[model samples]
Target: MTERDELVPRRRRDRRGRGMRGPAVQPLAATGHRPPLPRSRREVFDKIMLDVVTDIDARWSEHLGLVEYAVEDAPQLPDDWDSGRVPLSSLVRGSGTTPTRLVVFRRPLEHRAADRADLEAIVLALVVEQVAELLGIEPHDVDPRYPSDLDDD
Candidate 1:
């Protein structure tokens, strides 16, 4: 073999086994900025839920004592379910010595929302409606931000 052939470096293999891949340097690492936080859809939904619950509790914590809030991936529906649409949330009133529980179904709410802002609106609306039911008051009384156009029917 010619010396010239030996002097030429062999090309590095990539993911495809064809050519080079990946960035020369990771984007944020080179800039001296910290990496962005990693969050999943469920995490995002939970944060939104926490914000809404905190706001509602500030106003009605006295009237609605010992309430439990939760976020589930999706609700279990029976085969004979009659509703035209799936439920985005569920509320179970507590009896004597039991705390009331409110559950937000994350998948259904995420599916119905078009974007982040819409998701926030939907979460707020559901919480307001549930709180209204618990307190036996209008949703508007529960939160002025409750969407005016949301239909109860």
Candidate 2:
């Protein structure tokens, strides 16, 4: 072998091997922010709750004509039933053109799911249900339907 060839470094092998793949990540959080503080189950639920809220804002802020929306953390509940809880309560206080309110019970929703996929489905469903209820429309109206062209594949 030539001295120049010997001087060159060899290509390193992929650590995960040929066909292995990592889990897909959703754009759940902002960039360059402090890592979320998830000490208890509530914190975990809070993070997921925020994701759902953000998704709503991204998808329907203009359509809903919403100036703003908030996701209040679920109040502390009994430890025995707080792992993945999501409780929903709504109120119409103002006399004229009352603002919409959506409260997501974090602990109960989290408890209802067995895994991340389940958690995502539950969160999306909860958001859809709440938004639909607020708008007095069917839940399907709030859900994002796939384009018909995608079904042609």
- Candidate 2 lDDT, tens digit per residue, 15-123? 5455433333323353334545547766666677687678777777776654334455455456677456335544333334665556665556666789877776677
Query: Per-candidate TM vs. native?
Result: 0.77, 0.49
lDDT for each of the candidates? 0.88, 0.60
Model 2 bad stretches (over 4 Å): 1-39, 67-87, 91-98, 145-153
Error of 1 at 54 (Å): 0.7
Q: Highest lDDT: give the candidate number.
A: 1
At residue 129, what lDDT does model 2 achieve? 67
Clashes of each: 0, 12
C-alpha positional error of residue 148 in candidate 1 after TM-score superposition, expressed in Å: 1.8
